[model samples]
Target: MKRYPTVLTIAGSDSGGGAGIQADLKTFAALGAYGTAAITALTAQNTQGVRAIHAVPAAFLREQLEAVFEDITIDAVKIGMINTVDVVEVIAGVLDRFQPPFVVFDPVMVATSGAKLILDETVGVLKTQLFPRATLITPNLDEARMLLKKPIESVDQMREAAEELIAQGCRAVLLKGGHLVAARLYDVLAVRGEATQVFESEYIASKNVHGTGCTLSSAIATYLALGHALTEAVSLAKAYVSGAIQAGKDITTGQGSGPLNHSYAPKPMQIRS
Candidate 1:
């Protein structure tokens, strides 16, 4: 007998269908993984900016996690847009109970349109309670600056930042360098005892990159569920996101930052015995 390689995305909902849970689910389906979600909050936003946010209660969030874990055989997990410390704790507890194989935490601090998402206090809780539980924490340059409380201006600084983030108890860190002012984009991956690795990609000039972080992390989790190792998964995921951006470069979805073409190359769900 065979079953789909399922991934659970414990994140928030985006009414505009660009980022947050919407992007996660879209990436999962595009990469051929069965997608599941336990929403932590709801945001009324578009490609322009966030208007309002309604957080899901901790009890209901726990119920959602239990309901999914009790039924599906989850292969990998992706976490995004956690709004409160309560939601963070609830998710940490549930993850501790289920112990999924892969947990990619996208520490989404700010939206692409310069809107803050998570609270300052919640960031501390996430670092303490959820960092150790996460398989890899993917933070953009700005988020890294918030976490490290310093500047990461150059490639060498990014590598140093990745190492410092791993010291915060996470097993590994993928410090994104999209914000760096350079011709080519670079991302550093630092594992606990392994040597750091750098991934370089051509800088595609496109405004439709609103959900690149959410999409990349979810794609990495999907590749992990599909049996790729950590480094391999990141490489494949970067390629997928680059392709999505290039494919949707000319298309216009909203007045502000648009979204990547997640379904640019859809694949059928994969089966596992």
Candidate 2:
């Protein structure tokens, strides 16, 4: 029997099922890749906001990573919500050992509802250890601002931040523009020694965008696992997220922000070759 491309998500678990490991797995399955997860934290959250978070022990997190790596061939990895320094170190150690082909770091320092997810200490660990190992670091405006320790007010600022992140050892950076108060959504992809590419899309007016970032990163990882180039994967992932936002706009999953329609254009899994 042929084997399917497998994408793994190392992140927190959102009880709301809209973001984090839940959204990552949904995006992976929708994009025709098998999904696995190693949850770093369990959060009591909803569309409104996060109420509480319980982080898993670092040893257990390592065990989860080992269990998956020993059993399945992880084609790509999407890492999100490493809330503590120990958690970040543990994940970094696992990645160093396994060396997955495509490692996409979402750098989920902040949540959609404006909650701080990662601790200050973990930021240093992420930049020192995880950032250098990532194939691509996907950071939204707030996360970028925090990482670079500067305010990003415009697309120009986004470009500058991407360059700085690249200098910190990230192979590539996808600086997200969702938080920008502009009519056009612009995402900048910057790689070392290459001209940066900008992905522009019409900003869809939608409140159901809770997991948009997670879904997009996971989609990119899935496409990359299926052998798409970085630029192509990001372009397609942006389009997919835009469509998901549009599809889920009118639906209400909770009292506040809702989830994207991850399976809106779901395709049947192809026989692995």
Candidate 3:
């Protein structure tokens, strides 16, 4: 029997539809994967900023996970905004039980609009519980700084941070350098027992960068679900994101930062035997 490359997104809901669960699902569809979602939190937000957050209970989250995993064979999972310690524990436990093939953890701490997303207390729990389970931890400069408690101002620091993050128990790290002030943006990838590799793209000067992290991680998960190796998955995901950003540069979605044009080059859903 043939099946669609199915990827699940465990994250929050963005009413704005640019980032979080919405972005994850969009990226998955754009990259030819079937997307499912379990909402951890719901944010009343727009491209301008997050106004309010309503968290889903841990028990409900557990139910969502069990319902999906018991029926659908999830190929990969893209994790985003976990707003509380309980949510972290629930997701970590579910992952342990199901053991999905690929888990892309996008440590979403801050919004592109400069709003804090995750609680300070939840940070430690995420590191301890989810880091080890993640196939790849994708963190931008600001999120990396919060996790490492140090400055990551240059490409050198980005490379070093990827290795340092690997010491925290993750199989790999893709330290995103989009936040750095430079002509070219670099994302450093460091896998356990392998040399670090760097992915570079020209800095696209645009305000439509709201969901870049979520889009990139979800794209990676989708590619992984579609049978790409980890390194190749990251490379292809980067290209997809760069193209999305470039294609959406001139488009306006809101009063503030806009979203990537996810449907710019959508592919038909992929299938596997």
Candidate 4:
């Protein structure tokens, strides 16, 4: 028998089991990948909002990465919520050291319930240090606006913002257009030297949309681990996320916006020769 494709997440822990490392692992598991984590922070958060945050020491975060790399054969890495310059540097250092095949970054700056998740200065550090190293960077419109220091409220703006993000650093950019108020959703994907592709789907109205960013980025990383090309991986990932959102819309988990149905219908464990 063959082993499952191993995927690693370097992000924060969500006690709520709906976002961050929890969501990443669930996405990985549902997509038939072996999931591992190197948590950067511990957040006391749930469907409502983040109540408290305890940052993990950079040294400890590095130790976790080293342990994961040394023990498991990771096929891809998804990075989220590196909320400090020190931890950002540590992650960049470890990433440079390992040079993993595929690294997907979800620049998570704000929570669904309107809480700031990262410091302003840390945004600069992430763009300058981490973006260049990532194979793909997925940022929602709000995060895109934060990065570009401008507005992104239209599909035209999303295209412009996505292209600009690519010019700034990441090898490719997937600017999520979920923030736009519309019935039809367009997620812009701009890769280096390729025509931009917009993945459109009917927006599922769901208040339980807590972990989509984490889920999508991790889903893309899992598809990459399964040997899909970057754009194709994104396409597949988008489909997975759409299904999850729709499946979870009718379910209830908490008073606040709940989570997607990641495991409602999981794919079989993916194997590689």
Which candidate wins on lDDT? 1
Clash pairs for candidate 1 = none
Clashing pairs in 3: none
lDDT per residue for candidate 2 within 1-273, as digits (tens), equals 699899999989999999999999999988889999999999999999999999999999999999999999999999988988888889888898988999999999888888888888889889998888899999999999889889998989889899999988889999998899998988899998899888889989989999888999999999999999999999989888988999999999989999999989997774476
Q: For model 2, what is the alpha-carbon lDDT of residue 24?
A: 97
lDDT string for model 1 (1-273, tens) is 799999999988988898889999999999999999999999999989999889999999999999999999999999999989999989988999989999999999999889899888998999999999999999999999999999999999999999998887889999999999889999999999999999999999998998999999999999999999999999999999999999999999989899999999999988889
Worst 10 residues of 1 by lDDT: 161-170
Error in Å for residue 25 of model 3:
0.9
Clashing pairs in 2: none
Give the TM-scores of the predictions, in the order they appear. 0.99, 0.98, 0.98, 0.98
The lDDT-based order of candidates, best leading, equals 1, 3, 4, 2
lDDT of 4 by residue, 89-155 (tens): 9999998998899999999999888889898789999999999999999999889988999988899
Angstrom error at residue 127, model 2 = 0.2
> lDDT of each model, Cα atoms only?
0.94, 0.92, 0.93, 0.92
Model 3: lDDT to the true structure: 0.93
Worst 10 residues of 3 by lDDT: 178-187
Candidate 2 Cα misplacement greater than 4 A, ranges = none
lDDT (tens digit, per residue) of candidate 3 on 142-252: 999999999999888888889999988889999999888889888899999999998888898999998999999999999999889999999999999999999999998
